[model samples]
Target: MSPDADPRSAPTSPRPSGLWRTVAEIERHVATDGWGAPLRLFALVRTADALDRDPGLARRLPPNVLDEARADPDHLTSVEQEGVPAVADLDELLGQLAWPDGVDGAALVVERILVPPDAETEVRAVTAGDDEAGRARALAAHPLAEDVRIAVGVLRDGRHECAVRSRSKDSDGEVATGADLVPGLVGALAATLQD
Candidate 1:
């Protein structure tokens, strides 16, 4: 599926579902560190399941967090993966990943430069003969290009959600949330959860 031309027009929810909440939380967490950050991957687990498997975690996690999990069966806890290697190709990186059985879902947060539909032809012409680095530079320098951080989450059961934060509209309230905001990334994350 193709992404929406204007991600800002995507749906937003005051009370998001479990997967949507997790994806939006990941996006906000990444935003705290500012831009130019590396790609981040997280394993989503049902909070109650995790606490049940290791009751000791109850002491480690905040009381409010534990309470919420107990109240909501769908609550999810995001466990970030560390020491991930930097890769030029996102698809290749995702292709190499396979989650363990305990992971109920997976999420990815990444930054990208987007050119508006009106500028697509000009963008293609500008970077036509350029190499990877040259093409990146050309796109970054494009006047109409936008910098956005996208968070996509997918469950083993096929549920998916996305949250997008454009640099220009940096506030948390302005974030756009929907299922198909980033269809390609959602598909990639789903692939990693395959058995």
Candidate 2:
């Protein structure tokens, strides 16, 4: 967490089922343009979401933290949300999530998963069985997530990051493809980043 942010101030309202939208957006741009643009958009939206969720942060986060988060990568250390350190780096890229490498459709492997970048930032989110868990789940059709109901914190680089990754236990935390519905998410991300 940034030194000057607050987590409790987050708005308590229904979350937007923006996965399909995000996915479609990303795919649309990538298929039409290039990866850099789509990824930039993804990062911007993702960074914005993270800030809104953690207001107590340093305020000058996006430009600074992103400098690290992008290259650092988010690693899924465990399917069990509580065990992971809040500031740990993700294990792989969304496409590298072997769990859903070949599955189909957006399915939440976990109820809701929270993805904390290695930069020690958290985007407190709620999973309604429809929310994508993280970048990986978003990429996979069956998304996973960890809402505020279950949260943990870890220390990395002397900073705190969100700790809690949700997966559909029933699905054994595997990823399914949402190629049909992903362009939205990807496209939106691309638009914001590509600029």
Candidate 3:
């Protein structure tokens, strides 16, 4: 089965039940810091039988899907493979999610991208270049390509979010998002289960 087709292939889980609280903290940061680009959130969930109870899986799934996993979970199925429809009211959206009878756990991967305010001008310049090399060079110099800060975070079955990857001025270049970025809050939303 395709990795996206099987939840068993999903990454190991993060600390359960801590994801939501962690997410709340992250959200506050996002609210204050604000995103320079649109933030996207993706959720991956599998059947309860599939998780096999591995504790660390789903704790750190990147925003992208996994190609393979060591041991696939049983009765694996997809809950929401595509990006969530809306993040405008992320807290309210997360508050409405719940796992049905068959689902075991899930991972929430949030990506916040920041493009330099002047990216459009740079892109136009790149497109106007006559040769491939010139175009490539121009594109490389664009803020969207180089001057970008991405925050990626994963939250799983447990309530709390964990292991964030991000690019904040404060973070020296850690792969995980910190409070300076907002994936933590997004992670919490995905891990949380509400009525």
Candidate 4:
């Protein structure tokens, strides 16, 4: 893909069935677009319906937590606030999880990121030679981000899909693409299931 090209605009096959497919797509986008930014992730957990049915389990959980779990047995969601620490954390994070009362299967959603310009600063640095540092500093002064949404969801059933959509931060133009920004992050997310 050209540096100016948007990966999201490229053709995508029908959504794949397993987390590994999501992992592969993330790798492909990164190879084509170059990695950009840190990724934000979310974890979705489905609490057990047995919480409501099992009086003993109900007693162990806080009333509110139990009530919420009961009210939405199939939709318990939790987010990991810290940015992905490492790819290994993907599996580790999931393994470390201890759901309240009745949580069961889990899924992951990785937020999208902006695709940065190719060598915007590096080119300037090379041209400036002895003053390379100064040139790089100038380029960093004004930063622009192309608002894009390329979120990937990996379900407990191993079903996954990457959704791409875009707009400027100011909401000016509309175009779709951004997965190029955080491929490794998405890979880590997918690894949770793959591992």
Candidate 5:
């Protein structure tokens, strides 16, 4: 899911209760900053259950994510107690997932990008390139990325142009509590928008 996404309320998943539990855990951690050891233990178990449903989607919770979750037990007490620390530490980890290159920029290489700022910018359409067309389609779909077209050869050496339309704008937890929230947010938003 893109970083700026705001997930609508999830009304349709098998784990509505689990979602509430996760969200409660998040709120507890966010509010008290002291999610308690019980919260941590519960989170681990719930996360395990959530992961069991879809073993394929690990980007939201890479193998090392728990390590981030493990960093601050004291902060796990509650949102006000652990909220700042959990929010800070977890966001530190989530931000890494959001901005893998340490926030400077991402290794962007597009075969076709519909330039955002100006539609008249040079563009190209190449079938030989690998990621260009797909990336172009994605960029074209975003509301922030409009008025751009792919020219045949406008961007051979060019990468991303650092615009308002980026994939990981908010560092996940910067908005929500966990990067794990991304998939849910994506699903919820897709359903809402589709409806």
Candidate 6:
């Protein structure tokens, strides 16, 4: 999805809520840049609150977005966090993250190579003793491996949303959206909102 694409124009499954729409928007926004991008972190703030804190945003946001924010109290605006440290391990990165009171939630956009289920055993064995870089190379070279970009969002109230787009089927229409798509990633994101 292009940066200028309307968030509401994206197709979603099972009817999307405000949080889900925000997550999907983030997924599309990142997808525009194509693959091999680094991990991205976003701060999800209530749209009403964001506008209240920064009135100038009213002019920058897309048309009718501010109006929708005014109509829906649960609407969220995602602000990308820049200059994030390069971390080899996602778990370690998320474990050290702590959101402030102003942040209503957090979202993480990451690209991963997924091997077919039948190749899991062999893939693990081949990369068992390799370092992170070695494992990444091995996975990328695997014939059955598929590259996927996953965006997961979690709210302080325990709400979660996930969007997954594979390189093979890279398009706004092909994105898969659901609540429990990536439970583990959702859990890790939720931990960041913890006290």
Best-to-worst ranking by TM-score: 1, 6, 4, 3, 2, 5
Q: On residues 112-133, what C-alpha lDDT tens digit does candidate 3 reach at each position?
A: 3334557745565647546655
lDDT of 2 by residue, 137-186 (tens): 44333223333111111112211111112233222123233333233333
User: Residue by residue across 78-179, what tens digits does model 1's lDDT show?
Assistant: 999998889999999999999999999999899999988767667667665756687777778889889999999999999999999999999999999999
In terms of lDDT, model 6 sits at 0.91
What are the TM-scores, per candidate, against the unseen true structure?
0.89, 0.18, 0.33, 0.35, 0.17, 0.86
lDDT of 4 by residue, 112-159 (tens): 334356545544645656775575455544354344445565554444
Per-candidate Cα lDDT values, in order, are 0.90, 0.29, 0.44, 0.46, 0.29, 0.91
Q: Which candidate leads the pack in lDDT?
A: 6
lDDT of 6 by residue, 1-195 (tens): 899999999887754589989999999999989899999999999989988888998999987888889888999999899999999899999999999999999999999999877676676677757566777787778898999999999999999999999999999999999999989999999999999
Candidate 5 per-residue lDDT, tens place, 27-142, comes to: 33333332122212111122343444556544666556545334422111111112322332322432332311111211111112234544323233322356665555655665
| lDDT for position 195 in model 5 | 12
Badly placed stretches (over 4 Å) of model 4 are 1-40, 47-113, 116-145, 164-185
Between the candidate structures 2 and 4, which one is better when assessed by TM-score? 4
Model 4 TM-score is 0.35
lDDT of 5: 0.29
lDDT for model 2 comes to 0.29
Better of 3 and 4 by lDDT: 4
Once fitted onto the true fold, the runs of candidate 5 whose alpha carbons sit more than 4 angstroms away are 1-15, 34-43, 46-195
Candidate 2 vs 5: which has more TM-score: 2
In angstroms, the error of model 3 at 139 is 27
